[model samples]
Target: MEEEKILAIDYLATTPVTAKDKRLKARRDPWMSRVLRYTLEGWPTTVDNELLPYWRRHEELSVREVCVLWCDRVIIPRVERPAIIAELHFGHPGMTKMKAVARSYLWWPGMDKNLEGTVRACERCQQRVKAPPRALLHPQLLPKRLWSRIHVDYAGSFMGRMFLVTVDAFSKWLDVYATQSATTEVTSEKRKTSFAIHGIPERLVSDNGTCFTSSEFRTFCESQGIIHTKSTPYHPSSNRLAERAVQTFKDGSRKLETRSLNETLQTFC
Candidate 1:
């Protein structure tokens, strides 16, 4: 018959040791070793009277055989503490679920408190917590004049070409320009051409796309004496003026199935 492997604490205390074994010992070794030694020998009179019942049940068994400390429940050995907890709490489960799983298995002193702390400290669990209440919307004042505030955005590769879309906040005037690329340089040049025709707007608004948020784009707006404003990150309604225009353009383009790209642009113009 195969001999039962001794508990970790018992093996460490009785076996011949090397310098490496001493260095690799856990911080709780002293306390665990003493507990194992006391368990192997008969319980002393000074031992906690509260544990008398547990000792009576387990006294007949060797230290390796009765690794569990059954005072409250079957308490796991110190060496297996972290691994057992991790297995019970895998997938960063919520506190209630973790507690339920832990209670179903071998336990330790302060197990509930330690589980709480572990779950609380988990970065993934913290991130998955419900977000705080969203603040109320504070809408921007309506523009008093045409071209005073302009919203810009990009739409489509309808015919293998993207369009730079601009919409005036007050007039609701829409301008769509087919572009070879959506790079900052290309977009800035397109905007410059439009600015020359319509005059530069007091405020230019766009989404947080790379073309709009680029340093080059900001410099271009600065040079033109235009205030550049970006809509709230991931909030499309803030730039609804440009979004509506893009939708309108796409809806109109879809109907002109027989028309070529140039013909479609001419019809829209």
Candidate 2:
């Protein structure tokens, strides 16, 4: 019989505890025990809800000596997850970067949420959150009153979140929303939120992004009694207020220190 080769996760090379310590901890872990047994023997027909996450991915799981692995990534034990999270977050790399690095090396149940929570709870990480590169600020046609004419644009994936940036042309008051999507639905929803506070604008200006040009968005604007205008195709600068609003958001976010992305955006304004 050919020997089964073991895979190594580069991130585990610098584990807080040694491999022997990890093996010892793994031996004491009930979840790891089940995973090890299932991989070495055969997966059971069914599992309780707590273990269902593991059962779903059993086919990709393997063992290296006594350590549990999900494909090439280490399945970190529950006891060591805090230390592991600390090590992963050592440099105060924000939630997004930490998650990306963790995916390359190790995993745990709720790892994504865990990583996000860690950074949110960490003061150093929150203080050092950076924004996208600064862009040139352009002047645009001013309007007569606040909320009469507004410029809108998308900014991100900045600090692991997309943002809908709205700038009132008359007042230059900024509103930023941390969003998971840049879809037409999300865009309109954000606009509605702004409208609830400041009332709907008479004219809305944006670049030629599909989120703005889509029929769905056009209908949304028409329904709201808004005059929607798009910048010349391939000439985003024509919608100078929104373009500069995005730049202002990026520039403002860099100097911000807040508990969450949404708070950072709110505080910047």
Candidate 3:
């Protein structure tokens, strides 16, 4: 049943009763018929002004059976032009690709502009257009003092507990704290504990996770006189220091089997 429905849709899309097909059929009217007949009957010395160009370009032209004219292809009628463009763009290719495909088997004046217009107006193509290329990375300035700038991130729900990890940008010192949950309060508490040990950082960088972006986290940073900066969403390279520390901790934890979380943390430190 599904296959039959799909076939029926295909048939409808390609049916000859469409507006383009009807206009193509209408090309058999007097003026076009006469032009086709003249092309077939051989070039006239004094041709219709409209047809003089075709005759002059006759070396590039061909005539099909049933008196249809071809110039690299069956000369598409004006009303059927959009239909041909639509067919070539069925794959929703960009303007250049569509124009290349059309040129392979078709020719018409202003066809390039028409293909571009069709592609631009295509909803699917517009919706699926790729994002602009990312800008090159601009590295942050190095911290002059140890623990002045810290990159912080969370790692794990390993063994049902989460660990907050911080890495000092200058000294590369790492601090890890296990927490019951990754909520803003728990994360802030863990960060406070680390600040007490290393002294408060002048700047803190982190990914745009909920715990980092929460109002409570902002308030905590404000109270501590810490400048909070977030990396671009979904981009871990911008937070590479913290990410590296998290990976290191995870690797160490995985190596110690049958050890409690505190034991693993101690081993990692």
Winner on lDDT between 1 and 3 is: 3
Q: Runs in model 2 with CA error above 4 Å?
A: 1-140, 233-237, 257-259
Clashes of 1: 0
- Residue 1's C-alpha lDDT in candidate 1? 9
Q: Output the lDDT of residue 78, model 3.
A: 52
Q: Which stretches of candidate 1 lie over 4 Å from their true place?
A: 1-141, 233-237
What is the alpha-carbon lDDT for the whole of candidate 2?
Answer: 0.77
lDDT string for model 3 (23-55, tens) is 455374544555566766766677766665556
Give TM per candidate. 0.46, 0.47, 0.46
Where is model 2 poorest over a 10-residue stretch in terms of lDDT?
Answer: 1-10
Error of 3 at 22 (Å): 99
Model 1 per-residue lDDT tens digits across residues 176-252: 89999899999999999999899989999998899999999999999999999899957644787787778667755
